[model samples]
Target: MDALANAPDILSATAENTRHREWRLPRRAVSWLQVLPLTAILVVLFALPTLLFLVVSFFDYDRTGIYPAFLLDSYREIFTSASTLRVYGSTLKFAAIVWAITLFLGFNIAYFLIFHVRNPKIRIIFFLLCAIPFFTSAIIRTMAWIPFLGRSGVFNQAVMGLGFTSQPLSFLLFSDFSVVIAYVHLYTLLMIGPIANSLSKIDRSLVEAARDAGASRWQIMAHVIIPLSKTGIALGSILVITQVMGDYFVVRQMSGGQSASIVSALSVEIQAMQYPPAAANAIVLVVIVALMVGCLLRIVDVRKELMK
Candidate 1:
């Protein structure tokens, strides 16, 4: 009986000692000071600029790039104009085509890298090749395409030399075809990176097991690999869609300012000091990108798949 009574006292005393120790111990914590600089940078560079643009979208621009304190006129012009609507439709169509092409091509390249290439050194070399374009300036890369696709360029010379055509193809340059081609070349690396990262995480044994279970190569790819690669597809689609939607430089260069994409049109307004209309166009682009990202999030739980 005495021992039982003393047991509660001993337990209470131990609990009290634990409390005292916890109170006395200095808490080792990660310092927020380290994060503050990055946080401040994000606020200044991204958050503030985005907020300012949003506010400017609601104002009215005059000849001096200054906007009258107002709302609705810029947005009204965006929606009410038939030309703007046509441009919006064209932009959406272009974005869809780019997304589909990037997804298909990116998946194939990533699958080849992960499954076909067993040699690590060769794989690294190939990946570096994809990444090397990014090291050069985007302007220079776009400019390089001009000479190759121009009337007297190498492509035209090759065609002429082969006796395929007597005259250079006028459709090859300063058109939507050129724009799409440039986009595919420039953004292929972006698509490849995410797909490769996702493919790297998949277990090779699962594929082997599927094959051993009397599954054909096609069946294994369709049933096993593709389902497992949904995250990569989703990520690549989002990246391609967002990039193509907002891209100005490549489209402007390839189209030779003869045609206008949404971004290119918006740039024109900005250059003319039509800040309000430019801001309005920017907001429209943001909304479109947000909708695409939201759809992707709904389709795939990227965080969960990434964790796996």
Candidate 2:
């Protein structure tokens, strides 16, 4: 009789536990719920806009207006145009140069802050100093370079005053050099932010262990830090590349209209009421950017690297 009575109690406990679990959701379902808002926003904003452009890119258009139809002429024209090739080549060149410069600056700066600095307060202060420029308008920042880099600008005046040169440097403003300078100023922060975040999460104990094993700073950085920071470096490179590829004004103003970006060419098409061709350009640029990012991801399994 006692054994039979205990069986009933055990059954009741199991049933109660099952009932409690019924009130909880599966982890996957909870994950989906968490992402629902952003997914909806992306579908509405990015997805819908991209779809709209894709449709317009296929439509027929001319001097009269855009017509509703499917055609390959827009893509054909874009692919066939030598001007399109030149603009894209120029944009890629800019992206590549900017990515290299930003990566070096960002990695070194982040490394110093995360590893070299013992004081948390000073590290944060230095990071804030790097970010302080962002509080001002980007346009103002780009234009400010004019007075600092022009023939009679601060930099030129300083060089001449110090007898470094007989005349002010002409290439300092309104040239490819100036465009690069502006890009580095604007986008280096993007690189620094991602890299700093990645470096911060690294296990400090591993670095110490490496040092105890007689690993020099260079060896530790080569074998440990660089391997660990791949995700950050890739992310920073992506940000810098994309920003340089899509830019218009900085190149235009700083280069003195001598150079044009893919987007600048696209902007020209838009201004001329060439919607189909402009939409085509937009789609192509998106594809190119996506391909470049994809290549970076392939180079580093960023997901696996970060999780580890």
Candidate 3:
């Protein structure tokens, strides 16, 4: 009688365990299902295109048509040509200058917004003001600078009226000066957003403790705030760097015909149906950018920071 009673309980326990495992198997599969769509999109859109470019870059091209052949001529021309070297140097220089300017402006503005602005509504208003320029098209915004910075434009007139200079500044428009100005205007916001997010996550109590421990404001900022906010700085730097590096339009239009970016040169090649060389140029640019981003990742570990 005792054995019969225990057998029913044993059968019930086994059934419960079996149902639990069945439920768990689908739950595990659901996680993979959630990730599948994004994986498919990346494979199809990004991976396939990149692989195609790599293959095409090795082929031969002529005035007749592109020929299927593995050749290093395209890369050789890129590495050997003096014009290519000069353009690459110019683009790198512009990227560095723009990165520095944006970092300074972005950090200070973000610090002010997060720590100094006590009112939430005022903070929102300030952020909105920062973003207002983006409401217009980037091309329109870029073109607007041309008129403003032109010889007969508002800034020159103001400077002349104020006796700052006797002549309209020729360097103000269609020059490297104008290119840097436009880049700063366009990309400072990218830095500001990331830095502000990092700043917001900082603990107030830590700051207060540091303040109470005879630490000066500057010391606290240097030791406590900056260290904590580096992830944001790194992220912002990456964004600003990439944007400046990849820019063709701002550099072309703002600097007039005096300057040529890597992209602009590649675009010219593409226009002439120089597919192999253009593909090679693209691959080289991608590798250079990847190396830069890799350097940044090595420094900050953006993935690790975000997880915390």
The weakest ten consecutive residues by lDDT in model 2 span 23-32
Each model's RMSD to truth, in Å? Answer: 9.9, 8.6, 8.8
For candidate 1, what is the TM-score?
Answer: 0.85
**Ranking of predictions according to TM-score:** 3, 2, 1
Candidate 3 residue runs with Cα over 4 Å from true position: 1-25
Which candidate tops lDDT? 3
Model 1 whole-model lDDT (C-alpha atoms): 0.83
Q: What value does the lDDT take at residue 158 in candidate 2?
A: 98
Local error of candidate 1 at 103, Å? 1.8
Who wins the TM-score comparison? Answer: 3
Report the candidate with higher lDDT, 1 versus 2.
2
lDDT for each residue of candidate 1 in 1-308, tens digit (9 for 90 to 100): 99965755565555556765673332221124335567899999999999899999998667866655868888989999988888888778878888778888898999899889999999999999888988998778878878898889889989999999999987888888888888888787778888888888889899889989999999998999888888888888888888888887777788877667798889889888889889988998898889889999889999898887
Question: What global local distance difference test value does model 2 have?
Answer: 0.89
* Cα-based lDDT at residue 164, candidate 1: 100
- Candidate 3 lDDT (Cα, 0 to 1): 0.91
The reply for model 1, stretches above 4 Å from the true place, is 1-36, 65-70
The CA lDDT of each predicted structure is 0.83, 0.89, 0.91
Candidate 3 to truth, TM: 0.91
Give lDDT tens digits, candidate 3, residues 175-281: 99999999999889999999999999999999999999999999999999998999999999999998877887888899998989999999999999999999999
lDDT of 2 by residue, 108-212 (tens): 999999989999999999999999998999999999999999999999999999999998899999998999999999999999988988899889999999999
